[model samples]
Target: MNRATLLTLGVTMLAPLGSAYAADDVKVVEKPIRVLAGIFSAASGANKQRTAIGVGYDFMKTAATNPTVYGVFLDYNSKKVAGVTTSLTGVGISGRFYLESANAAGKPYATLGVGSYTLKAGTSQSKIGGKLGIGYELNNGWLGELSSTMIQKIGGKDPGGVTFGIGYRF
Candidate 1:
């Protein structure tokens, strides 16, 4: 074969392979804000167990490797202490640190937050609180987490304890 003809054939044969590599290099663009909803089971300082519903939003565009999330939660139980029913409400802002790349499947993360918590019974009391948690997230946007929270004493009793939750990101 002539040299010019051989070079043309080689270039034509490799054209599709070069395009495939370019396609693989394309990166996925994610939405700036991700909304989430979930349910959590919590134990209070009084040793009462209650279930709660929570909702939150995550800021996807961050300088850090992980995302920052903000959340609001409410929980109540019929169990009365000293003949009084009690309920707790709170809002928190947390940051997640991923063990691996954010887009990896089955990724694990650690979270820390500070917030304000309120307790309501016959009267209402509010205090500052902090939370620490660990979680695992699937590539499909489902996550499970376990956390511990500590709220400053209200009327000489702590209002926070351990919580387990499941959430979905949208």
Candidate 2:
């Protein structure tokens, strides 16, 4: 082979090795715990649309391509409806399945949870409920999500609503 051709072949063969070494030098740090605080806007169903404050804690390591996060959340809202003071509170444990790598710039996830919810309007009743949700998380530790919760029948009416939330993970 000519010197020029040999040099070209050598460079081409070495380029990938150089890139592989560079990739090995790049380390990805994983954060296993995330704390979140946000707002929840209840969807209209058995109750009027109301906004509530929510807090959550998630335990998941970002080293996996698809990580299942275990989390717990609490939400509370109080408002007057038809001249009656009403309050709703929910506490739940959830499992979130991530669609992509947690280290990805924008990751999508689906969640399922079960919990007990209490509604107080003149009287108070507690019911077992389930929730389903989808969320998008950004690389900067911010996330936006929407969920629907369905509580057991209370007074012949199912008290449940959709919730929207924005949170930060740290």
Candidate 3:
């Protein structure tokens, strides 16, 4: 037990892993990016179809863990069928789960989304939707939103809709 006392107990256990690489080295803070659009509708109450226009995007955050918002959305859904003059184009990939309460400051917050629609005579559809909405954030960085999306078309028998939207968040 005396090889210089086992080399002084392995240099006192490697001096706490060499003082953890001299500590202080970890600083990363970068969060600034948000974009949104407006106008969307797909509705039916015994064929009372209401479809609108104007849509937008630019929102990317794969996973957020503090008031849930997991995202990847670049969406555009259009419609114009005023009497069979047919017009429909939906190109999308959308997924969102939302909840944000900033201690009730200028209130309104609740969102839930799911989308997969590709229809420009290419017939590919999937949308299981949700939206019970209210949103307000105006401190010059305008974010005024009102949402609703209740879609069900996962195989083709397309007749399910409820989308009312207004958005602007940059």
Candidate 4:
């Protein structure tokens, strides 16, 4: 090929490469408060599924390097045991690592938290445990999450359950 033709081809190919994307060009807004509400269910057994609706909130400082979340939540689990009504309530505080993608369209996160709870059977039983979950954070400040919680029982059984929920950041 001639040098003139080669030079023309190189310039055309390099022109597009000059327009590289920079993360600095994208604006990252920090939200002061994040609130979430969702439903939770625990896998007990046949005719024994614990259920609850919960609300959560997060207040923390944001860092460009590592996105973080700090929050607390409570759930009220009510079920029918032996044809009688029973209720279990739990509360916990957690911090999560929020990971944002390069495109900044969506964010993924993992969380770990610890707290105490109470169950009302024949008597009120108090227990302590930790919670874990993985979820997605949308650019629009909406989030979806799946979680597993484990709270030890008092003279009864293990009170661990799975939860799914949707939340928003403000």
The best candidate by lDDT is 2
Inter-residue clash pairs, candidate 3: none
**Comparing 2 and 4 on TM-score, the stronger one:** 2
Ten residues in sequence with the least summed lDDT for candidate 3: 24-33
User: How does residue 3 of candidate 2 score in lDDT?
Assistant: 37
Summarize candidate 2's per-residue lDDT along 5-90 as a digit string, tens digits: 43453344334434544555322334434444444444443346566666667633233467666657786766776788767788
| Candidate closest to the true structure, highest TM-score | 2
* Alpha-carbon local distance difference test for all models: 0.57, 0.66, 0.40, 0.62
lDDT of 2 at 33: 44
Runs in model 2 lying further than 4 Å from the true structure: 1-47, 60-63
Deviation in Å, model 1, residue 139 alpha carbon: 1.4
TM-score of 1: 0.65
Per-residue lDDT for 109 in model 4?
Answer: 82
Q: Each prediction's TM-score against the native?
A: 0.65, 0.70, 0.24, 0.67
Clashing pairs in 2: 43-162
| TM-score head-to-head 1 vs 2, winner | 2
What is the C-alpha local distance difference test score of candidate 4? 0.62
Q: Candidate order by TM-score, highest to lowest?
A: 2, 4, 1, 3
Better of 1 and 4 by lDDT: 4
lDDT of 4 by residue, 1-170 (tens): 23344345334433322332232222234654555555556545333455566666664423445555555767666767677766667787666666664247887888766667787765787777666789898777888888887766556566667777777767
Weakest 10 consecutive residues of candidate 4 by summed lDDT: 17-26
TM-score of 3: 0.24
